[model samples]
Target: MSTVVVTGGTGTAGRAVVNALVAAHHDVVVTSRSTSSVHGRVRTVRLDYGSPADLEAAFHGPDAVVHCATSFTGVRGGETELGRRVLAGARRVGCGHVVSISIVGIDRIPLPYYRAKLATEKLVENSGVPWTILRATQFHELVTRLLSGLTRPPLVLVPDIPVQPVAAEEVGARLAALAAARPAGRVPDLGGPEITTLPALARSYVAAIGRRRRVRAVRLFGSVFAGYHAGHHLAPGDATGTITYQDHLDAWVRTRR
Candidate 1:
């Protein structure tokens, strides 16, 4: 079994990747800023991405590294610096393969987070390490989280744009599988089984939670929203995931009970 290290293994996608790796019987080690309760039999280490020493220590002796860590806001060039540090540490320890999880159509999206992801991708490509980049569309849980935050009592405001939401578990499984195999650079993008609108997703979320909120579609004025509306973030040719948005909602509602 190969030893694999997953950064940000406590977060949604990271946790799913860790679980899949453990189930595959690989020696898995997860790193985060702080210790948390992990589900499976795996090792957790404290890793501060800003500290090169800590990053190298965490990356030591790993056969492969699946990079799932990302800053949500991508402010102050933090994400780019983190990516550089990860590459540096991986190179210092002579890690074989570095698999990076990126977002779909990040190159087409002009948002701050998407820009940061693109920068990270460039870093991995030039890091001189054998690397594989798997770009996936937005996750279902992210859509639900966005909708939940916009639920203002009687009205649920949603952006008027299209999205293809994939399951984090599926993305994680794909990352794990890639980590085990030979490094293939820039694989096919993964997306949801169907293309859906934001308003429909919000309505489904409201119905799932049994809320009486009126889902309203609002036209957001921004380049980011324009890109989303233009379907730049979709993978029409690469809808590889099988989970539907309704399936995600059903599972989410069941968890709340």
Candidate 2:
């Protein structure tokens, strides 16, 4: 059993990664800046990203590191730099492998967040930490979250764009597998089981919650939307995920009830 550390292990993808590692019977440590109720079997540690010594200490003893910590909006001194810190810390402790999760179409999309992710990918490539990068499509939970942002009263406005959202757990499982093995550079892109319009996904989510809200598709403008509209963010060729969006909402609704 290897000691595997997951950064941002409380968030959606990070939490899923931590769970998979624990299920695999690996020694798991979660590093987070924030606190949340996590698995009892998993150990949580607070990391001072600002302190190099502390970061190096946090990096100690992990056989591998699965980097899921991220923020696209440049919050808290920019999420793009988190990769650099993680690399430095991992290198300091001589961690064998560092697996970083990234989004699909980051290279093609011009969104600020995508730009930041692309920059981080570059950092990981040159970090000299024996790294592996897995690019996956957006998560089903993220799609729901975005749709929630569009919710205005009784109507949920959704952009007219095609999306293929993979399950967070599936991506986490893949990352765990990668963490257990030697560094393999960039792997194949992972996407959802099927492609669907954003409005369709929103409608399903609204129905799952028993909400009487109408899901209306709106044509958004700008280069970001243009990229989405052109399906630059889609991975139709790699429908490697098995769980459907409906399956995701069904499980989520059960948790709420």
Candidate 3:
């Protein structure tokens, strides 16, 4: 079995990717801040990225590394810093293949977080390691989280923009396969099976949660929203994900029961 390491093995996307790797019979090493976040047969380790020795030691003897760790450090370059640490560790350990996950519209949108994501992507491409990068649309969980935050009691005001929210598990599965295979540069963008507007998604989320709120879609003009309005963030051409947003909601509700 190939020895593969996942950087953020406990987070939403990372957890799914770890599960996929385990199912594929790989000797998986997952990194988590808390030991309680890890389980199953895979090896779990804590990493302190600031310490070069600790990072190098964590990365030692891995066939491949799937970097699912993400920090939404807008404009400050913290996201790219995280990537730099990971790449340095991998290069030191001589890991053969490195796979990274990114967002689909980071190149098209000028939002601070998206800019940070794009910067991280550039870092991976130029890191001198055999690497593969997968840019996917937003995850269903993220969309729901955004909507939840916007819901202020009686009403939810969402952007008048379209979204394609894919399942984290599907993206993780794809990343796991990429991690095991040869490093092919940037792969096709993965997206949801359907294209939906923010207001519609918010309405569904509110209904699913049994929250009494009216959802409204308002147009907010900006370079960011313009990018969204132009559908630059969408992936209708690469809508390969199978899980629907409703499907995610149903499964989430079950967890709360």
Question: How much does candidate 1 score in TM-score?
Answer: 0.95
**What's each prediction's clash count?**
0, 0, 0
Each prediction's RMSD over C-alphas, in Å, is: 1.6, 2.1, 1.5
Taking all chains together, the TM-score of candidate 3 against the true structure is 0.96
lDDT of model 2 at residue 60?
A: 89
TM-score of each: 0.95, 0.93, 0.96
lDDT per residue (tens digit) for residues 52-79 in model 3: 8978877899999999887876646478
Can you tell me which runs of candidate 1 are displaced by over 4 Å?
36-41, 73-75
Cα shift from native, residue 27, model 2 (Å): 0.4
Which sequence of candidate numbers ranks them by lDDT, best first?
Answer: 1, 3, 2
lDDT of candidates 1 onward, in order: 0.90, 0.86, 0.89
Worst 10-residue lDDT window, candidate 1:
34-43
How displaced is residue 81 in candidate 3, in Å? 0.6
CA error at residue 209 for candidate 1, angstroms: 0.9
Lowest summed lDDT window (length 10), candidate 3 = 32-41
Question: Which stretches in model 3 have alpha-carbon errors above 4 Å?
Answer: 36-40, 75-77
